[model samples]
Target: MVSRILNATVIGIISGIVLGAVLKVIEEQTTKKVYTLLLNIDFIPILNSIQFGEMGEFLFHLLFSIILSFIYMSWTEKSSPNSALAYFVKASIVTFPTILLYFPLSFLALKEVPAINDIQSIMFWTFGHFMYVIALSVLVYLQQKKPRS
Candidate 1:
């Protein structure tokens, strides 16, 4: 049990790092082009700000990923037929309320001061959350699928 938990934690951290890197690359490339196209603007300043201050984001996601992995493992342990698909469905259900709640709260708490009016920004932010959930779910599925030795 201890070993399984430890393995799950390690897998979660690795999954988090991979997901974060992929997101960062996608954001850099896509945001750069999108911003440039929309406003004839460069994303250097935004990227610089993030570079200086992204540790909290990374830690938060890492911890959340670890928790999600544990939850999925627990669910799988219940062992119904089609457990993998059930886990995926359960994950999606769990993610829905988070998606619904976080975006408005994030906008209100963080972006309200600037009064962000860009629909694209809103969409991108929500899309990031969706991708995070998907990544975590995939990690959980992969961990659950590993053969016991």
Candidate 2:
């Protein structure tokens, strides 16, 4: 159980970092602000009281990713996914709803972020999440493939 938690945590950190960096680069190059959207915490009440800057906001995002990884790994343990493709599909199924979060997050954010209805930003956000799931799937697949010592 401790090993599983550690593995999930590592997967979460890596996947979260990949998603954050990808969106950040996209926002920097295209000015879509999807990265800003990813890091927004203004809707969370008390957490919105102060600015956490990029790194802090990123840590907040990592928290969610880690929690999500825990849940996903737990589910995978039950489901016993046998292939990389199966892991990818399960990860996608688990995270599909997050793509829609762009709408609510944009609406609720007090800080500057992409508009709720911005089509381009929505596309970028969806793409970033797809990448995130891919990262999670690949990492989880690799971890599961390892022989237990």
Query: Candidate 1: lDDT of 69?
Result: 66
Q: Which candidate is the best by TM-score?
A: 2
The TM-score measured for candidate 1 stands at 0.60
- Clashing residue pairs found in predicted model 1: none
Error of 2 at 110 (Å): 1.2
Total residue pair clashes for candidate 2: 0
Please list all clashing residue pairs in model 2, or write none if there are none.
Answer: none
* Candidate 1, 1-149: lDDT as tens digits: 99779866886677557556655664576662221121111133463355323565467667866876676566656753255556667766655664464334434442222124555555554565566566656666776677877
Which of the numbered candidates is closest to the native, going by highest lDDT? 2
